[model samples]
Every structure is written in structure tokens, then in C-alpha cells.
Target: MDTRTVFLNACNEIANRLDGFKILEKGQRLKKSSLDKDIYFEIYFQSSFRNDSSSILILPHINIYSKILKKWQIEQIKNEYSQGLIFGNQIGYLTPYNNWKEWNLAGLSYEKSINEITENIQQYLFPIFEIFNSKETAIDFLKSNGTKFNQWSEDSISPLDFLLCFSENETAEAFLNNFVNHCPYKGNILKLYEKLKTQNEIDLNYSEFHGADKIKLAFIKGLKII
Candidate 1:
């Protein structure tokens, strides 16, 4: 079988075995949403092109999302610079078992790769989906999963966003007091923090907010935190 055929076949096999996920992007992506449709676990394929035209590595990536947050993000996109924070979910490869990310699916290895992928989804991802199945659990998870917040991080979920989205202004300010110190780009976080602490509102336009502020402001405005 050709490399492309092997990739598609493996994806199809996974779709057949997995119960809830719906096929997307013509089989390149798999999406499983929660019963309430508030949470989503997206499994997708990535190709690692090799120098040898014969070899292919079909890397599988899975990430979780909140249906509410997704919609909130769309509402908050006020300008060209403002962007969505898509990491309502995160995965280290198909599963995050010990932060594991290893994939090799080319030619005959497709069967083994598919098996491993299915097992990882069952073993690691399903449990996570259950954990963050609701916005309440998801907010609590981000608050507890302290990988240390970096205000400069582009894609990483900042707990502040959750706080702002959920209108936890008091807690968010306390967090910002310390978090801003860690972020060298503290201008935006601090400004937002001070506004919440004193005025209880954010007046900055989406364009005025830079970097991680995009997430913070989105939560504040979209969720109407004031």
C-alpha cells in the first residue's frame, strides 16, 4: 500500500473502533464531544516528512476543547490581532501518559500504530474527558494544573482566562499579583489585573491588548465578567 493509503486506512480503523468520535476533515481528524456537547476531544494526524520518500511517520495528536469557550472566543474576536486560545484541552501526542509522544506509522506499521493509538485513547484520554467534561471541572483543572503560567506563551491555557471567564475577579487579581512578576511582558496582565481590582472593568479594546491579554480580555468581555 502507498503511504497516503496507509495513513487513511489507519484513521478509518481508529474511527471504526472509537465509539463517540465523528470523522472530520475527510478522516484526518476525529472529534468526540461530551454528552452535553460542552467538551470536545479532537484526535488528528500529523505527518513527519522524512528524507527517505518511502518512510512516513503519521503522528497522532489529541486535544480537548470546551464548546462554551469556543463560542466565547468567536464572540471576542474584535480585531485582526485578537485570536482564540484553542487549548481548552492539551495532549502529549495521542495520550499524555508520562508526557509520552511517540508515533511511527508507515507501511506495515500502520496496524500497530492504530492499535497503540486506540489503546492510548482508551487508557489516557477517556479518563481526562470525564474529568474536564464540564466548564466547572475544566476551570478547576486549569487552576490546579500549575505548570507555571507564562504571560508570553502563545498557545498555553492561562488560568487567568478561566478566572476571568467565570468572573472570579477576586481570585484572578490575587493570582495576577504573583503571575505578573513571572511574565516579563507584564504590561497587559498588570493593566487588566489593576482594572479588575479597582474599577471592576476592562476598558481596553481587543486591539490594545497584546500577547496573552488576547485571552484575558476575551474571557472578560465575551463572558461579561464585569
Candidate 2:
């Protein structure tokens, strides 16, 4: 089968597995929207040409909208862009599709490719939905699993970032505080540390420094100033 046929079949299988979700196919991209329309997962079949060969790759992107968090994000984006935030915050992850060349060179079959796509959805994509479905579920998931700070990225805020922004739950608060305390930075890191500890929301304006500062502040918060 051709790449397009295989890609569409894989998308159909994924949509079927998701039940109430709807899939919108636009050329080589398939967007999966949640039943309530508040969440979206974009799957892209990216084609690249190199040397004398061409290959198809898959990519996944997520957009989540929570009524509770939208206002804060809107205010932050307005303050940052002056045009306001038009879309919900979105994130993407590394997937097996990124390594399509390895599979293709290994003579991976179309059926096996579909199975790999399904496994990727189950292992990586669905967990994100489970964590972000609601503020309550998100907090519960964080409390139980702890914040996935290692997954922090500059492009988008993870579930842990969302919890830090809006959740006043004791578990969330303590986790942030503890995370800050255990960091390795010292001296000037206190300013950012105190800001994180005292602020109710992370300023999107400072997002460039957000990821680095989180690690630094976590380590330097309580150190004595020289």
C-alpha cells in the first residue's frame, strides 16, 4: 500500500479506538477533537525527501482548553503579545514516528506501522488526556504521580505547570515548594524562587526564563545571600 493509504488507515484505527472523538482529515494531517470540543490532538504525516528517497513521518500535537485556566492565560498573553491569546495552550511530544527511517530501513510492514501508532497513542497521548480532562483529575494525577518536571519545555506548559499556575491544593503547593528546595542553584536564584513561591500564576512574559529559573530557584530559595 501507498504511504497515504497506510496513513489514513492508521488514523481511522486511532479514531475508532478513541470512541466519542471526531477526526478531521486535512491533507496529510488528522486532527482528533474531544467530544466536548475543548481538547484537540493533531497528528501529522510529514513527508521528507533526502538523497534520492522520500519518507513519511508522524507527529503529534495537543491543545487543551480549560475554562478555569483560560482567563489567566488570556491576561498573560494579552500582556505579552498585546494581541491577546487566540488559542488554547498546546504541546507536542517525541514519538516513534520521528524514527520512521529506522523502521522503514528495517522493512517495517504497514500493519506493524499501524500497531506502532496505536501503541504510541496508548503510551504517550492518552495519558495526557487523562491528566488534563479536568482540574480535579489533573490535581489528583499530580498528587499521585508527582510533578513531571523532567518533561518541562519552553514551548508549552505541562500539566505540572498548569497545576502550579492555578491549583491551591496542599499537595500541589507542597510539591512545588519541595521541588524548589531541592534544586541546586544558589545566590541570585532566590529572587525567582520567592516569586514562584508567592505568585498565584506564572507570568507568560517570563516564559523564556521559566524553565531554567524553575530549576535554579528550586535549588537556591533558602540559601543565605552573600
Native-to-model Cα distance after best TM-score fit, residue 21 in candidate 2, in Å: 2.2
- The residue ranges of model 1 lying beyond 4 angstroms of the native Cα positions read 49-53, 77-102, 147-155, 158-162, 171-211, 214-226
RMSD to native, candidate 1: 6.2
How big is the positional error of residue 136 in model 1, measured in Å on the Cα after superposition?
Answer: 1.7
Query: What's the lDDT for residue 73 in model 1?
Result: 52
Clash total of candidate 1: 0
Q: Candidate 2: deviation at residue 58, Å?
A: 1.7
Q: How many clashes does each candidate structure show, in the order listed?
A: 0, 2
| Cα TM-score of candidate 1 | 0.64
**lDDT tens digits, residue span 16-99, model 1:** 898877998768799877667766677777765451335666666766666555555555544444232335333453243445
TM-score of each: 0.64, 0.55
lDDT of 2 at 18: 56
Tens digits of lDDT, candidate 2, 62-170: 4554443455545534443232111222223234333222222113554576576557656755666666555566566565545451243222223433554456545
Candidate with top TM-score is 1
